[model samples]
Target chain A: MLDSERLATDSKPNILLKGTKEGLLLLLNEVVSFESLLEDLSTLIHGEKKSLFEGPDLKISVDYGERVFAASEIREILDCLAKRENLILREWGPSTAAKLSLFNSSRKFGPQTLLKGTVRAGQRPVFEGDVVVIGDVNPGAEIVASGDIYVLGRLRGIAHAGFLGDWSAIIAAAEFAPMQLRIADIVSRAPERDGKPLRTFMEFAYLKEDSMAVDKLDSLHAWTAMARQSS
Target chain B: MGTAIVVTSGKGGVGKTTSTANIGTALALLGKSVCLLDADIGLRNLDVVLGLENRIIYDIIDVISKDCKLEQALIRDKRFEHLTLLPAAQTKDKSILSPETVKELVGALKELHDFVIIDCPAGIELGFQMAVSGADRAIVVTTPETPAVRDADRVIGLLEKEGIRNPHLVVNRIRPQMVKRGEMLDIDEIVQVLAIDLLGIVPDDETIIKNANKGEPTVMKPDSKASLAYRNIARRILGESVPLLSFEEAPGFWGKMKKVFGAK
Candidate 1:
């Protein structure tokens, strides 16, 4: 009888509930309307499958694949579960795409953020696209950009370019004495005994062979020209 | 109204209380009416540093709680006629005084004095918040050490976030010999890192400790290097443009003789 009931529920493209070692996994359908999902969830808990959840307390983890659940939508799902006293929500796992979507919705890419004056210690300025600083980035400050990062003055702190994983992005500064550099997924720290005098010329950091490499800014023009000719 | 400057360092043992006592005393010696407010609460040391602990009948908490009048809580300094101290309470914690209460107290003190110097407690907590709430400007004190400069940078960031822009930097306890040996961070390095205007730099002098032990501000001793630095800072605060003092050691007998003979 339980197999037949599961067969009946499997025919519909709605919520899929499966038992695992961690207790129960509830996979909510992404294409179905949220109202219908909630209705189907309530009916399955209170209707024919009621006896299945009648045992001891069972942990339930929700996996909303490619669907971002709003607070109200989550509360509705919780309300549907609250009808059954034995079911407990142990985890909420949102899809990676959905998590990235949430961040993308807040900040738009393509445009640069221009910051004037020094970015002192404890100041972190983050941007979706390129970031241009007109002044110094002092020690302990951080600048993060989804694209390139350009500092007109000293860049002595941490500068993370291509924070969203754009490997083509770069970080350039007038005096490059950074504590750390991150380009895309690559990270590099300044060598110990970095007490050398400030460089006279501008320098930049880019991802080379899956590692961060530094070179004088003059080399970037030639590299870009070569890439343009090759393409 | 008078200006209120809060002396703060995010790290302890960087001489916030000592700087406050000395700066306040230096300002008073310049003929300005100065009120030094000790906001450390349970760990009050500004009074003892000023040697006015025995004269404190009431404290800041007494004034804030209305247990005593503001005038009654202020202890007049024995040496300086224009200097007064509003001691911190010993038993109560910093939570006893809210930022609004401190703002009000500082407002009242500003009306009666030319400068209200608040000695901030260490660390960025409620105590630091309460001390910073009443100040019109800030004086960030730091030593030449890396940790001290880092902490000072953090405090300067917080002060800027609180809308105190262009806060002055006072690099204290600078050992000239170490700086000359390239073993310590020099003034230029610290100023470059902090990117703030240098108000003054106080040299590490044994006389400062001796004077502090004797309940006398180093600024009172006219011959001490630290005293001269503090006086220059006070003069600058009074809108005087004194040149920065070079930390070079005083000339020896031969150097002085060469100068007397007009020889290079």
Candidate 2:
């Protein structure tokens, strides 16, 4: 085993390894050069300290403190960790105040489809990926998407997002008076009033736990925090 | 060279036949030769509404089957010199008429008339298809009710799918008093939901029922509100820009007193 104090003081190590309740946590220093960090990580995993990661099915999470890695650099780090057969890469991301962008991240969305006309009544537009409608969706129309749904106009019809059961998907519109909204497996209907005043600002609907919750577009921080914690 | 306009409403009793009779009469009154074709075969009522039921010796089925010439089956309107009526068969089912046969008949009629107005039957079945197959334009008639507007939306979607783009809308039987009290949908609301151009708006009036019962279209009675509305719609169809009729009701005695006291 390696001495933690000695490694911290000697040569100012760029990588630190700690055991957590979930599994192993690797914290990478942002100041060090990328090449040196990769070198140190490889040396630590393949050298004399390899016994720490030798356990069966140990999950490892990498937290890059205030550092953003390019796609190729992340691939290089993944290749270095792939050397250990028992270690599984669980989660890897930047841990900083800028993490609020996790909600706007495009990684979870599938291919997007752009529809340019109004979805009139009796029209059902189904897509395998995300769907973006540039016009109004009438009362009897329906839209089904496997990922997120974005409507630039009034959404007066039925919208089903995460059709294949992706719970994190969301439905958003400029005028959010939908006849019915479905996110993942949960469904919500409009209130029982014929004259519910139309909303002026943009609104969005998302799944909280087991039910659907609606909120204004300005309060996106709550969505970011919820998404980060759920994932 | 003539334009064929099909009047359609997916749901029943939204005044498809009444609109056809009145609009055709209004157009003929404007000095344009017009032909009214009733496509509701088993439920034929355009002739009765137009007061030409007694003059129909041969029906559209006779014309399609070559049992009679198209001119022989066409009944000249007793009131308007330029108006003609081709009544539907009383006993024949709507499924007997194919799209191709209706297209050929409309093509022949177009050669001799300035405008051919088709009265489409309720429901989006073969009758509706046959009526719309020969039209160059479409006028979707809908009331302000939700079911009627929903059905109109569905029919407009089908029309657009069949390559009839930008169909006009005519809101029929709107009561101005209910609309003023917010108890009924206004014209703007209906137009916004349907997302189509407004052709005209007909208010609900007792004169329309009386005129229909007398076998005279409401357009022939110039004193009624619906008659003026139909005239405006016909003028608009003739490429004239006519402002929409004001649906505001006259102020009551209390309202006039309040207005006199400078109350808004």
Which candidate tops lDDT? 2
Q: After superposition, how far is residue A138 of candidate 1 from its true place, in Å?
A: 1.4
lDDT of 2 by residue, A92-202 (tens): 877622233333454556689999888989999898788899998999999999998999999999999999998888899999889999988899998776576787689
The whole-model lDDT of each prediction reads 0.86, 0.89
Name the lDDT of candidate 1.
0.86
Candidate 2 residue pairs in clash (backbone atoms < 3 Å)? none
Error of 2 at A167 (Å): 1.3
If you score just chain A, what TM-score does every candidate get?
0.51, 0.56
Residue A148 local lDDT, model 1: 92
Tens-place lDDT digits, model 1, residues B1-264: 899999999999988898999889999999999999998878988988888878978888888888889998889899977899999999854455899989999999999999999999999999899999999999999999988988888888899889999899999998888999999998898998888999999999999888788888888889988999999999998989999888888899999999999999
Candidate 1 residue B136 Cα shift, in angstroms, is: 0.6
